[model samples]
Each structure stands twice: as C-alpha cells, then as structure tokens.
Target: MEKKEAFLQQLSKENQKAQYHVMNLMESFRAINSTLELDEVLKKIMHFALNIVETAEAGYIQMYDESLNKLIIKTYVGFNENISHFKVNIGESITGKVFEDGCFRLITTRKEIYDSMSDLSKENFDFIDKAHHNNQKIKSILSVPVSFGAKRIGVMTFHCFDIEDGLSETDLLLLQSFASQAAIALHNAQLYTEVHKSLDEVTHLSQRLKETNALLEKRTYIHNHLTELSVQKKGLKAIIIEMNKLMDRNLVYADYLEGNYVPQHIKHFAKSLDDIFFLFTSKTKPAYVSICDTVQIDCYIYPIRSGSVLLGCLAVEGSSPLSQLDKLIIEQGAPILSLEIMKLRSQTEIMYKKTYETYHHFLKIKNPQQAEITAKELGIHHHYFLQTALIELDGNVDLHSLENDALLLLKHLKEKITLENSLLFSYNNKITLFSSARDAVSEAYITKIIESSIKWWNERFSVVARAGISTGHYYPGQAEENHLKAEKALLHLKKQKKKGILHYRDIGISRLFLQHPPEEINSFLRETFSLLWTGQEKKDDLLHTLFTYVQNNRSMTSTAKELHIHANTLYHRIKKIEDILDMDFSHFEDYLKVQLAVYLYKTFFGSLTKAGKLM
Candidate 1:
C-alpha cells in the first residue's frame, strides 16, 4: 500500500506541474498580444518560456540576422552568460537544425537517434557529441523554430536535466507555442529599429539642406556688395574729374607748369569706394579697387553734347599716369564714350574716327624718291657711287624721331660728301642715309652728329643710344646691305670695342682670317692632303717654319731680323722647307704654290703650332 501511494503522488505532482505551466503560458501569450511594445512583449515571452517550461539555466527570444545570415540571440532571461552576443548559423546547431527542418527537436542524447538520421544528421550529431563532452550527459534538449506568417526567423531552445528518457511529444508542443509568441515580438522590434533609422537619415538631410542655403545666402550677399562697389567707382570717378577741373581753374595760372593739386585726396577717395559700403550695409565688401604703387590713375570730365546742346557731365578714367598720353586718350575716347548720348546728326565727330585719321596720316608716306632727288638737286650724283657709309641710332625707334633723324643725317652728309646723289629713308627700324665716298664724312664728323642726335633724342626723354655705319658702294639694293652692316657694327659697339662708324672694307685681315679660321683648313688638309705631310712627320714642322717666314714677308732679311740670326742662318731653315714639302722653291709656279700653302696654313691654323710656340 505504501509503494502504490508514492507512485500515485509522483504522477499527480507531474500532472499539476504541466497544468501550472500551461496556465502561465496562456497568461503570457495574452499579455504579450495586448501590449504592442516589442520590448515588453519580448520580456514576457522570455519569462514564460524560462519559468513555465522549467528547463535549463537559460532561455531566449532570438531572430535570424539577414545581413550576417546567422541566428542572433535577441532577448533572454535566466542567462548568466552573454548568450545574446553569441551567434549560430541557420543550419549549424541543434536550434539551427530545427529552423532548417521547419520542425521541433527533442533529444536526450545524440547516441539514441544516430541511426534514425535526418538531413541534419551532420550538425545534429556534432552538437550531441559536443554536449556529451561538456558533461551534459544524455540531457534532454528541445528546439522549436519560430515563425511569423511565412518567415521562419529563429528557434527557441530548452534544455532539461540529463535523464535516461528524453522529452516527449507533449514537451515539444509547449516549446512550439513559446516560439510562435516570440516570433511576433521579434518582428515588432525589427520594424521599430528600421523606423528609427529612417528618421535619423531624414534629420541629417534637413541639416545639410540648411547648410546649403546658408552658403547660397553668403554668396548672394557678396555679389550684392560687388555690384554696389561698381556703382560707387563710377561716382568716385565723376567726383575726381570735377575736382581736377576746379583745381585746374583755380591754380593753373599760379603754378604755371606745376600744379598744387594733390593726388593723395584722389587716391584715398578711390580706396574709400571699396571700403565704406560695408558700414552702410551689413554685407562684407569685396576688394574692388586695386591700387599698385607702380601705377598711376588719371581722370577727365567733359559735357555730353549733341550739336552744342549740353547734357550731363561725363567722366573718363585710366590707369596710365596723368601725362599728355592720358590727355590724348581722353581727346580720343571721350567723344566716342558720348556718341550714344549725342544726337545722330551732330557736327561733332567721334574721337575714335579722329584718332584713326591721325594714325592713317602718320603712316602715309609720299614720294620716297624725293629724298634722293633732293640730294641730286643739291648738285650731288644720285647713282653709281664707289663706296658709302650708313649711320643708325639705337634704342626706342619712334617713327617721328626717325624721320627727323633721317632729315638731319641727310643735311649733315650733304656737307661731308658734298654730293647730291645720296638717299635718306626710314628703313629697317632705323634712320638710314646713303652717302658716297665723295660725300663720306670722317669718323669724327659722324661721331659729332651721333652725339648731337643722342642729346636731341634724350631731351625731355631719356634713353641710351649707339650708332653704326656701313662700308659699301651705294645703289638701289645697297640700302638693305648698309642697314645690316650698321646693325652688325652696332652689336660690335655693345662690346665697347670700336664705335662711331664702321665700314665693311675697314674690317681688318685678322677679322677676315678669323671668319675662316685655320682649324677649318686643317680639317680639310687632314682629310684631302694629309698624306703630303704625314709621311715624313717633318711636313708639319716645315710648314710651321714656312708660315713663320711668310708672315715676316718671304724676306730672308726681315725673317732673319726678327729671328735674331744671320740671313744665311734663316736660308738654311728655308732650304730644308722645300725638301720636306717636296716642292721647288726657285720655280715661279712652285713659289706661288708654296706662298699660297703658307698663307692658307697661317690663315687657317692661327699659329702653325697650336699655341705660338715653334714645333
């Protein structure tokens, strides 16, 4: 009777435990479904799963991570370790196998079900083996996959005390109910997470839009300031021109050529156009007025007129200094600047038209041959001159100055050459005058003219100058040749060597020889006639002495005189020269050949020896 009573008590206790767990699960499902808050729902689901199931130390409501493609522990209760941070792939563990198979699993130990293997045989058996190694001996473990609608998100796991008999079908049914409730809670949490993320992105976009608008507003403000400055610059120019007129009227007579009109006021006022507007409006002003120390500004004011009917005053300004040049620009630009304001039929012409007319006239030349005829009319021959010289000025060749210079050179050359045959024309950017040898002046006479011309050119203007002359006969084509020679002579003057006048005929033998130096001849001789000297090797020495003798002029007497020896002593040197060169010294033809060879050797080789030493 006692044994039977103990068995009945154990059965009743198990039945009551099952009823109590079911009651709590119903209550949790009711509470979670009522509260739409994902956090509260998940908390209640975990409590029911852990307390009602009365399983192992831990229980969780988890979901699958779509991005990582793994199961992630979401919320848990009764877990002392960080199981929420742990991960398992979809088909890799006992829970993963349940999710993959779309069914629940109840295993006491892997050894019991090894022969009844399913498609999850590999990982399921591996987990059972791992559990055995961990001293979870023959323990009953339950896994139920959670689903929301058609999506299986995760699994709910329950581990029980290791017992010989594993969990029954009834145990799996309770865990499946828990997994279903857990799925609903996890779905709500993910939706809430996505909504919060979208709100944060919207907030960031709004801030960026505000920053872009602020930048555009700043740019608009700066543009307005620049527009204001342009208006003020025009107003300032008018004021400056009006002041200049006033100063000109009040102090022009007293100051004579100089004026007491201080440019400081004008400069400061121009600077203020860029500086003052920022105070009037709260916008930062742009740097509109650029003042350089090396530059000068000038202004003019004139009344706009339509056939003498005056309109408002107009102001003109420029960067050039307030000189006659700026005055000329105004005399040229002012009327054109007023043409639109003026009446169409007004008698007053446009300044640009007048400027064009003036330049057109200046560039126009009439009767170029008149200068040559003027010389001929002065009783000088106009053609077939033996020799001529050309003179040209240096630095800043202004047309008006060159014209005046040509006229002056023609007058001076007439006095020197005393011939009416020369020609003076502005050609090759210089004042070129052609004078025959009869009309050719001395270098001193030419030098005096150049000095005077330079002084004249520098009056009220400062520039250095050089002049050059050519040595050649004057003809129609000789103008170009003379000009080139003058330029070459000018280049020579830049070296500070010879100056005043130069003639091509006056170029010394040294310069002529330098033109075709001996090295070129040496190269030719080495290429063409090298055998003539290379055989005995004495040919070089004999040539050297022969050149030395001819340079002293084939005179045995003077050659000996310079060599500091008797005539017979020098003859001994000369007689050996003919033998080594294999040429006759006595025959006139051979003498001429030897003379040419010596002349060529001396001219091309510079010195018979490389330096001026005897070989």
Candidate 2:
C-alpha cells in the first residue's frame, strides 16, 4: 500500500511540474515578443531553449527566408567563425533529413563506425574523420523539425559532447512542442517588422508629394499674376496709341508701342511710343502665344501717354465686343502706363515683385532665408511672424492665394513691426507666421491681431478660419514647435465643435475624445452590434429606441417627450436592452456594450434613412 501511494504521488508531481514549465515558457515568450525587432527576438528565443535544455558544446538554428528563397543560418552558439557561414539546400545536409521526415533524428556516439558510414558532404566528413582520429568527444546530436499548424518553418539542432548523452524520443517530442510556439512568435515578429517598414516608407512618400504639390501650386500663381500684368500693359498701350493719333504732334509711331503695325510714316515716327511698344512685344512675345497668319496690314500708332508696356496690339477684325477680362486689363493699364510715361521711369518695381513671386513660388522651401535675401536685394523687406491658420476652400482650394497671403503678411508686418523681426510661410497645409517680440505682452497682442486678421480674411473669402498663435519664437527651433502646437490647438477646436482661434496649451483631452471619429468608432460598434444582434428578432425596435435616446443625450424625459409616452415607458424600453443582449443592466460591461451598440447603430445604419428608414 505504501509503495502504490508513493508511485501515485510521483505521477501527480510530474504532471504538475510539466504544467508549470509550459506556463513559464508561455510567459517568457510573451515578455520577449513585445519587441518588434525580429532578429533580436529569435536569437533570444534560441538562447533560452539552449539554456533550458542544457545542450553541450553547440546549438544552431536555421530559418527559411521566402524573399531570398534560401534557408539561412540564423543563430549559433559555441561555433568558430569559420564554420558559421556553412549553408545547404532543402534536400542537401544531415539537417535536411528531419525536415523531410517531419520528425527528430538522433545520431549515436559511434564515431569510427559512422565517420565512414554517415552520408555527409566530403568537407564535413573530413572534419568528422579528423575529430574521430584525434579521439575527440563529439558523441551524439539531435535535429528536429520546428513547425506551426502544418507548415515547417525551420529546424533546430543540438550536440552533446559526453559519449553516452543522447536525447530520448520523449525529450525530442517536448522540444518539438516548444519549437512550434517559437515558430508562431517568430512569424508574428516578422509581420510586425514588415508593417512598421511599410508605414515609414509611406510617411516619407507623403512628405515628398506634399512638397512637390506646393511647388506646383506656387508656379501656377506666378503664371497667372504675370498674365494679368501683361494684359494690363496691353490695354494701356492701346489707349495711349489712340490718344497720340488724336493729338497728331510730329507723330513718331513707335513700333514698340504697336507691334507689327508699322505705318508708311514709320521713318517719321521711328522714335515714338508705337515703335517702343512694337520692340518690347517682338522681343518678349509670351511662350504661350503662337503667331497665326496675320489678319490685316499694319498701321503705325503712337502713345500720347505711356508706361513700361509688355506688348502692343493692333485692331484685328474691328467692331467685336471685348471679353470681360480684356476690358478689366485695359481699365487697370491706362493710369499705370500714363504715370510711367510721364514720370520717365521704368516700371521696375512691378518687374521686381513679379520676379520675386515667381522665384519663391517655383521653389517651395521650409527655409525662406534665400528668398528673403533675394527679396531684400530687390527692395522688398520681409518680416517673419508665427501663426497657425487653417484654410477652408472648395475641395480644390487655391493654394496660390494662400501663398500670396503669406507673402503679403510678411511684407506688411515687416513694415509695421520694425523693432522685431517677423516671417511668414506655409507648411503642412497651414500658414505659419513666425516673429520676434519685445515681451510676452506684445506677443499676446500680436496673436490677437493675427486671429482677427484670419477671421476677417475668411469672411472676405467666404470660408471658415481657425487659427492658433505662439508667443513670438523664443529661439530658432522653438518657432517650429510653436507652429506645431498651434496646429494641434486648431485641430482641438475643430474636434470640440468650436470655431475660431485656440491656444495649444488650452486644449483638453475631453474635447479630443468627443470629436466623432466615425470611421474607427463606427467599425468597432458595427462588429460588436452585429455580434449582439445575431440571435435576436424583436431587438430592432429596442436598437432604434436606444439610438434615439443616446442621440438625445440619454435623457429618458426627452425621449419620452419625443415618443409621446411616459418617462417610465422610456425607462422600460432601455431595460429591454439587457434582455436582448442576454446581459444585466446593473453590470458596467453590459452598460458599456449597450452604449457602444447605440453609437454603432447611429453611425453605421443612420445613413439608411435616406433610402426610407431602417425598418
């Protein structure tokens, strides 16, 4: 009786020990697997297995890389560097034997007998032959398949130095089970690595695309501005030519003032405004315009008053109505051209402004120092101001207009705030205004002014404006930080259904959570709601009532008022929520589920109302 009791106790103890080891193994795996680095995790796993099993001399692990289409030697211990690079195909080595058989293979310690008998490569055989001849103690080894589900990912090999040491079949089976868990962990680690790499690449690509878009938008704006200037000049040239003909004073019909319209009196009016207009247009005919066949013989015309005109135009098919834009061009040109001609000065200011705009727009840069220097050289002093402003427009917002606003603010503020240096630029879809201030009080005042300016601009443009401002930059890098904070603040206000300006430090977490992220929350609710609704029939009415209640802010009184029923009746309808979900309303978990279901129903199924209600 005593012997039988002792055996029973021994069996129970072994079972308990096995369970404890399994749990420990699981815990260790979970702890190490939190790292996304695949190679480091695998090496640690192999080292753990080696320590736990207490293998002698050496341990090696091999993994199959699908990308390289090769079996790679990943981790090795107790091996010389010279032998570490050894490799073999899937069907080639003694290691390959277990992979093919899907079981463990054990080699006994009969060195002399096996050296001449083992089916190993000549190089490997020679090494074993030398060891055996030298009477070294490499006695036994084991190789086993590491698998998950049905797929074998790799093989684990261990060697023992003592002559009589070889693992039993039971030992091999236990190792195989551990190997399976290792396969799963390694697979997960690799997947995580790939996901993070893809995300990094995507982020890099998005930044590049944004930069390219900004450059393109800037160029378009410059092009439009240049076109407008040319049209204005053309209109003035026409008006001056007409006025000169009426005055008829020693009419020197300058070809530069009227392109390709040389009159028979060309020699007489060679030095006239008409000649100058023709020369300018002939010299700088825009790249877009192509000279189609001439429609008429040219006639010389001279300007009575003039400015720096871009091109000259003569009447082609008279008595036709001018386009609205053409009329606008002519109206703006008359006064400017007349002033320039009378003042006898080149319109260099306009030219300088156009060039500056083109250069900056063509090059959308984070650092505007180069542009600012060039502008200063051309007599346009730029100031820096730090502001975070949101631009709301049609889906196709005019990026060029936004950039122009930035430039105007920079120029205006530079003149207004002379004591402090200020700059304005755009980044990440927001206008950033950076500046230096004498004190915090001045900075706060500047922020208020900027907020008001943004609101005024938005109203003029018919769009919503949200802005945030930083205290003038404390330092260089601090400006960017302030800009980022301001952007975050704007985002916070947008989330909380608050419009206008917000300071970053003032945004609260509750406001952030309230922002309806219909995408993620809706998906979560849909999944949970579907799971709950799977085994129900009359629960649709309960779902509808719950959604309506939550939409009305979970007020039973309001729900009853809307439903034309007693508050108790509304309470009873909510009570039915627990019965349908097979959960008690008293439990926090059930209440959370009910709330989630209501949100999901509204977010996902609310749109079906357009097709005439959920029912």
Candidate 3:
C-alpha cells in the first residue's frame, strides 16, 4: 500500500510541472507573434526560451551575417558580458554547430565548450569564462538554430551557470519550439527592414537623376553659347566677358598670344594677377589657389594646354566657390579658347613666313638700286643706315625651334632699333637681320642697341647664338658686301674658341698678315729685328723674348712668365733689343712695327719654336 502511494505522489508532481511549462509556452507564442520588430521579437524569444529552464541565468541570440559569413551575437539578456559584438564562424563553436546542422546542442561540461575553441595562437576557453553571466563558469548552454523553412537564420542559446548538470534534451526541445516561432517573426521583420531601405534608395536616386538632368541642360547651354561666340567671330576677350557675366564674377582671359589680360580692357582690382601668372607658367593642372595674402580670395586657375604647350589660363577671382555650371563653362570654353589662340598663332606665323620669303629675296638682289627699291617695298627706309647681322646658332640649340626663335628676335630688333621698313629672316640655321635706321647710325651704336635687346631675350628665353655685326652702311645696296664682312668676323670669332657679339671692324690687323706672302712676312720680321740679331743671343730666342714681351704688352713680369725666364733677364733682353735696334721705345711708330711683326710672324710661319733653352 505504501509503494503505490509514493508512486501516485511522484506522478502528480510531474503533471504539475508539465502544466507550468505549457502555460509559459503558450504565453511565449503570443508574445513572439505580437510584433514584427526583429529586435523585440528576438528579445521575447530569448526571454521565453530561458523561462523554459528556470536554472538558466543568461542567454544570447546570434544572427548569421551574410556579409561577414559568420554568426554574430545580436541580442542578449541577464548577463554582464557585453558580447554583442561576439562572432563565430559556421561549424566553429557550439552555437555554430547548431546553426550549421539546424540541430539543438546542449553544452554541459566546461571542457566540452573549451575543447571547441580553435586557434593555434591561444587557448580561448578563458573567453567563454569571461563572457558568461557575472564572468562565472558556464555550467551548460542549450543552443538551437532558429530557421525559416530550410534557411537557417540564427542560433538561439540559453546559458545555465548555477546548475552543474546543466540543461538536458527536454530543455533542447523547448528551445527548438521557441526558435520555430521566433524564425517567423524574424523573417517578417527582415522583409520589413529591406523594404524601407529600398524605398530610401529609390528616393535618393530620383533626386540625383533630377539634379543630373539640370546639370546636363546647363552644360548644353554652355556648349551652344561658346559655339555662338566662336561663330560670331568675337575676340577671345568676348568669351571671357560672357563668362564673367554668366558667372557674375570678375574673370580674365589670359591671352597667351598677346601675353596679358584681354577681358574687355577692364583693369583688374585684384593684385594676384602676377601670382596667377606664376602658377600658370609652372603648373598645368587646373586648380583653385589662394593667390593673395592681402586679398584673401581663392582664384580659380584653369590651364589651357595643347599637347605639352601651356597656352594660357582662364583665371576667375573671388572668395565664393564656383557652381558646377561655372566649372563646366570653363571646361567647355578652354578648348575653344585654345583653338582661338592656335588660330591667332597660325595667322601670325603665316605673316612672318611671307615676310621671311620677301626678306630672302631682298638679300639675293645684286643691283644697288634694285636692292634699295626692294628694301622700300619691304617697309625699310631707303635713306636709313643698314645694320646687318649673320648669327651662327650654337650646337645645343634645337634646330626645329630656330625659326620660332628667329621670329621673336627679329621682331624685337626691328621694333626697338630699326626704322619702319626693316627686313629680317632666318634660314639654313643662320639668322640674317637687315634693318634700316631712320638716320646714319654708327655700327658701334647699332651693336649696343642689339646687345641690349639680346640681353632681354636671353634672360626670358632659351637662346644660344653667336652673332657678328658689320659696320653700318648708309646704302641698303651694300647688304651683300656687309653680309660677307659679318661672316668673316664670325669665322674669326669662332676660331678664337669664344662666344659673344663681335664687330666686323674689331677683327684687328690679322687680315693684313694673312693677305701678305710668306717672303714679305719673313722680310718684315728680319727687317724689324735685324740689328738685335747681330748680338750674342740666338735669333729665335730673341724673337721669342720680344714676341712674349710685346704679347704681354711690355709687362716685365708677364713677359718672363710667357718666356719662362727671370724678370731681370727679360728686362735686360728688352733693353738690349731697344739699345741695339737704335729704336726709341716711347715712339708709337716703333711700337706699331713690333706689334705688326708679331702678327706677321705668327700668320706666315706659325709660332716659331724655341731653338735655345730659357735663361
């Protein structure tokens, strides 16, 4: 009778426990279905699933992140572990195993949880110990995958720290029941989230399309406006003015051809024009630069480049930022402006080419009257003095750019020094400049003027040239004669291993020496030193001493160094030559003879070799 009574009592207690769990399960279903909010649904699912095991202290739900391809902890309750950012790969941890196979797992022993942690660098079993409720040991965890049909969503887990035996199979079954309902709520909430995102994106794209169409219309208007300006044949300044009007700002068209501002002749108030000019010369990229410290305005500098040539720039001044349309206008107008610049350069080059051909024809004329008449036809005054130059370009100068260099140089010389009618041209790597002066200008004066202009050119441009200037002649007919003299002078200068401006008349008496026969040169040398050679010294040594003395301008120290002799010896030799020749050293006539004799000796017989050792 006693055994039966004990069995009946135990059965009643078990029935009451079943009724309590059933009541909680029904409440959980109602709560999970109440909201489509994924967070609230996850929270309610975790809350009711933990209720199925009263000993389970804390738990967390981990959602599978498709982007990260990992199970990331999304929500947690009843735990001090801020493991919201915790992540696990599929088939990695207990929760990962549940997510992979869509099954329920119960982790009871601490070693079971620690054994699942994988890493060569560390034993991550401490991580679970620290991450659990109150940083206490995890006695057990019941993990079950929450899935919507065949697609697994997340891992639903319940933690039990106080119970040593932890959760059983019955506990796993209750968690599965909770996850089944939770998956439906999560699926509905995910669809709701995705729909809202798609709506926002659509709105954003619509607004962007509207803005893009407006920008396109602005660009079209700019294109037509620039084309009309081009067709109207208005100058490049017209484009600048139109842009300034369109943008409502002060802008300048940096006319590279004219090399200055050409925007309707309006004087710029901003002082950074020079600064903008510096930037344009150095950099080719379009940019905004704070051009001036005093003005505190950012200048918009747009470089116009054709290949590697920086033609110029469109510089706009103001502190305000330019609109997209303003930038587009500059971008569209830069190419048109570049074409205009190229057109202007082409026209100028054509004009120069015609002038070059005509000048070439003028140079070829032999008749004095015909050449003078030709000079007049080419705009040179018939009565004006003619200054001619024959320049040999240096080897380093690029041959392709010689014509361009000549164009600039001749233009400068003509404007600065020549009368209204001057003809100049470059051909065959030699620059010939023949310009008529208004009056009879001295060749020395003409040379000075050319030197000044060349100095200016050298400072600003890459020009390596050696030029020789002929004596100015009043007749334009003497052009051919003067060209020969300039060429002779240039040849003499080049033979001297030198570079610079040389005057034809300054080539000295070497011309006289070269024209004379060797017999006459030797005769003059013997006549000049005959009386001194009658003495004890050898003729060549005496000649060497006298030549070195005269070559050093009679300086005893310099003469000794040139002859490699003592100063006292050179002085005694010079005195002996002066005494023996009966020649007065003070007379210009005697000094003249000695200077000419040195020239004659060098020209006919070359330098006389030393026949005796130095004293």
What number of clashing residue pairs does each candidate have, in the order they appear?
Answer: 9, 28, 2
- For model 3, name the residue pairs that clash: 379-421, 380-421
What's the TM-score of each model vs. the native? 0.36, 0.32, 0.67
Note the residue pairs that clash in candidate 1.
375-420, 376-420, 380-419, 380-420, 380-421, 381-421, 417-439, 518-604, 518-605
lDDT of each: 0.51, 0.53, 0.71
Give the per-residue lDDT digits (tens) of candidate 2, residues 1-615. Answer: 999999999999999977876775776577557676888877877776765455445667877767865456787775654344555456555666666667776766656425523566666545433433234455677777777778878888776665545545645665676777778877788789889899999999999899778756644554454446455664534444543443323222233222234233433223333334434332433111222233322332213233223323322222334433333333343344445343322343354356545434423434556545543443334434333333222212355434333433333333444323544433323444544555567567767666666565455433355665444434322334555566566655554444467776565543343455757666666565553344344555565566667667767888788667788887887776656556675678876776666644443344322221343
lDDT of 1 by residue, 1-615 (tens): 999999999999999987887787788777667665667767777777776565455556557788998877767654434455556667765677677788877776656444333444455345434443244443566678889888897777765554634566766677777677767767776677678779899999999899778756644554444335344554333433433453322101011011112223344334432222212122222112333444543433333333322322333344334444334333333344344323322222243234334322322323446534543543335444433334554445454344333433434444444323443433322444445544344434554655565455445222234455555445532344555555556554544333355444454443334334446656654543343455354555445556667677687777777666788867876877666555676788877755665555543343455322322
- The 10 consecutive residues of candidate 1 with the worst lDDT sum are 250-259
**lDDT (Cα, 0-100) at 507 in candidate 3:** 77
Report how far off residue 169 is in candidate 3 (Å).
4.1
